[model samples]
Structures are given as structure tokens and as C-alpha cells.
Target: MDKFDKKILTALHENARISYAELARRVNLSAPAVADRVEKLEHAGVITGYHARINPAKIGYPIQGLIELTVKHQDYYIVMEQLGTMPEILECFSVTGTSGLLLKVAVHSMPDLQALIARLMQYGDTKTSIVIDVPVPLRMPEVVETE
Candidate 1:
């Protein structure tokens, strides 16, 4: 990507809903030119999707935690499919470690967390760590021009 493309990405990363005119002003391009670049970025897969960041606590879920699962090799896919059906799971990742999967989850209460754990235990051994405070939440990398 060029310097202008990088600037557009950086601007969008800061605020996805920015108007084409505003983006054009920030990038020193015409509105049509900015729109074209953004469309190209989207088509090229460099720009994925836009979303709103919401607080779980504000929406009834007050507790958040990470759950690590040690699943059998044969049961991995099964567990992955099942995870998709569970709305409490915010995110899941397959990482290189003793644990096969790591999950970020949110719940309404301690009892709900316990119940979720009970359900997950059927798939494999689980280790859960509740979040007390978020020193650093989710953030995206700033787009910078590469040499």
C-alpha cells in the first residue's frame, strides 16, 4: 500500500464511520478518490469489516474471563463446532501450548460462569481466570508505511 492508503487506513482505524469528505480532507484527496481507495482496500482484503465496540457490563453481562481448554486431538473439531453455538464465548483462538484452545467469555454472574464451566468441562479440562480490571482493552495496529 502507498502512503495515502496507509493514511486512509489509520484514519478509518480511529473512526470507521468517518465521512468520505472528512477522510478526503485528512488524506488530502478528493472525496471520489478517497472512496475509490477505500473500495480498493476493501476488495483487496486489507480493510475487513467495521463494528461498534460495546461494554459487556452495560448490556447485562458484568463478568468477563478467559478459559483455556485442553482437548483431545479427535475432539478438537467437535469442540470448535460447539463453541460456535455458545453466545457467551466472545472469542476463541487456537494457540501453540499445552492448551488446545483459549476462549474469552462474558457472563451475568458467578453462578453463570460456573454453569458455563460445567458445560465446557464435558468437552475437556478447563482453566478459567476472571478479569478483575482491564488495564488495556482491544486495540488495532496503526497503519504505517513500510520501506
Candidate 2:
């Protein structure tokens, strides 16, 4: 990717719903050129997908929790696949520590959290911690300099 392509990606990452003309303006390119570059990016798998960021509290899911799980074996892919299918599981990661999987879950209430934990325990050993306050839940990616 060139400098223009990098600028386009940076703008798109901030707001995926931006119009091609607006994106072109930001990147100092013509709309057609921006469209072509975006299409190429998508086709090449550089732009995998676009998603809407949602507020957990606004949708009645006020509770957020992190779960650390230790499985019987190193079958992370299978476990991650299963966890991904669950709606409550917001994110899952494999870390080099005591736990095999770290999961971020959002729930409506304590009962919902209990149910989620119960269901997860069926697959492996689990430990959980409810988030009281979030100073920084998520952050936007900074502009990365490309060679």
C-alpha cells in the first residue's frame, strides 16, 4: 500500500460509513480512484469487514466481565470456536499464562452472568471477575507509519 492507500485505510478505520467522495477528499484523491483502491483492498483481504460499535449499557447489558479459563488440553481452536458462537462472549484471546483462554462477556444482570458462567464451566475450568468501572474499555487505533 502507498501513502494514499494508508491514509484511506486510516480514515476508513475511524468511520467505515464514510462516503467515497469524503474519503477521496481526506486522501486528496478522486472519488473513482478512492473507490478503486477500496475495492482492491477488500478483494485483497486487507479490509476484512466493517462493524458498528455498540454501547453495552444502552442495550440493557450493563454488566461486563472477564473470564479466565484453563482447559484440559491445548485444544484452543475448538474452544475458541465454541466460545465465538456464544452471543455473550464479546471477545476471546489465547494468552501465555496460567489460563488458556481469556474471555470478555457482557450481560444484562447477575442472573445472566451466572447462567453464562455455568454454561462455560461445562466446557472447562473457569474463573470470572465483574467489571465495576471502565476507565478505558476500548480505544481507536492510531495512524501507523508504513515503509
Candidate 3:
């Protein structure tokens, strides 16, 4: 990607909903040019997709947590598929180390979290931590284009 493309990505990373005109202004390009570049970025898979960042608590989900799971090697794919069907498990990653998976979960109450944990426990050993507050929640990455 060129400098202009890097600028376009940085702008989108900061504000995914930014208007073409505004984006062009920030990158010193015409609106149509900005639109074309964004389309190319999407086609090239640099820009995956856009999403709304919603506060879980504001939507009645007051509990947020992280879970570490250790599952049977043979049951790995089965457990991953099961996790995909659970809405409470917002995100899951198969990471390196002793643990098989790391998960980000949300729920309306402690009781809900408990029930969810009970079901998850059937698949493997689990370690969970409830988040009481987030000082700096999620953030965008800084992209530095290489020569």
C-alpha cells in the first residue's frame, strides 16, 4: 500500500463512519478518489468490515468477563463450534501455551454468567475473571506503512 492508502486506512481505523468528503479533506484527495481507494482496500481485504462499538452494560448486559479454557485435544473443533453458537461468548481465540482458548464473554447478570460457565465447564477446565471497569476499553492499532 502507498502513503495515501495508509492514510485512508488510518482514518477509517479512527472513524469507520467518516464521510468521503471528510476523509478526502484529511488525505488531500477528491471524494470520488477516496471512495475508490476505500473500495480497493475492501477488495484487497485490508479493510475487513465496519461495526458499531456498543457498550454491553447499556444494552442490559452488565457483566463482562474473560475466560481461559483447556479442552480435550480431540474435542477442540467440537468445542469451537459450540462456542460459535453461544451469544454470550462474544469473542474466542485459540492461542499459544497450555490453554486451548481465550474468550471474551458478556451477560446480563452474575446468575447468567454462572449458568453460561456451567455449560462451558462440560467441555473443559475454565478460569474466569469478571471485569468491574474498563479504563481504556478497545483501541485502534497504529499502522505504519513500510517502504
Top-lDDT candidate index = 1
Q: What lDDT is obtained when candidate 2 is compared to the true structure?
A: 0.87
- Steric clash pairs (candidate 2): none
How do the residues 40-117 of candidate 1 rate in per-residue lDDT, one tens digit apiece? Answer: 999999988998888999999999999999999999999999999999999999988999899999999999999999
- The per-residue C-alpha lDDT of model 2 at residue 107 equals 95
lDDT of 3 by residue, 27-136 (tens): 99999999999999899898899988998889999899999999999999999999999999999999888787999999998999999999999999999999888898
What TM-score do all the candidates reach, one by one?
0.94, 0.84, 0.94
Model 2 lDDT-worst window of ten: 137-146
lDDT for 29 in candidate 2 is 95
- C-alpha positional error of residue 63 in candidate 1 after TM-score superposition, expressed in Å: 0.1
RMSD of 1: 1.3
Question: Mind giving the per-residue lDDT tens digits that candidate 2 earns over 107-145?
Answer: 999999999999888778899998889897554565465
TM-score of 1: 0.94
For model 1 the local lDDT of residue 14 reads 83
Rank by lDDT (best first): 1, 3, 2
> Judged by TM-score, which candidate is best?
1
Off by over 4 Å in 3: none
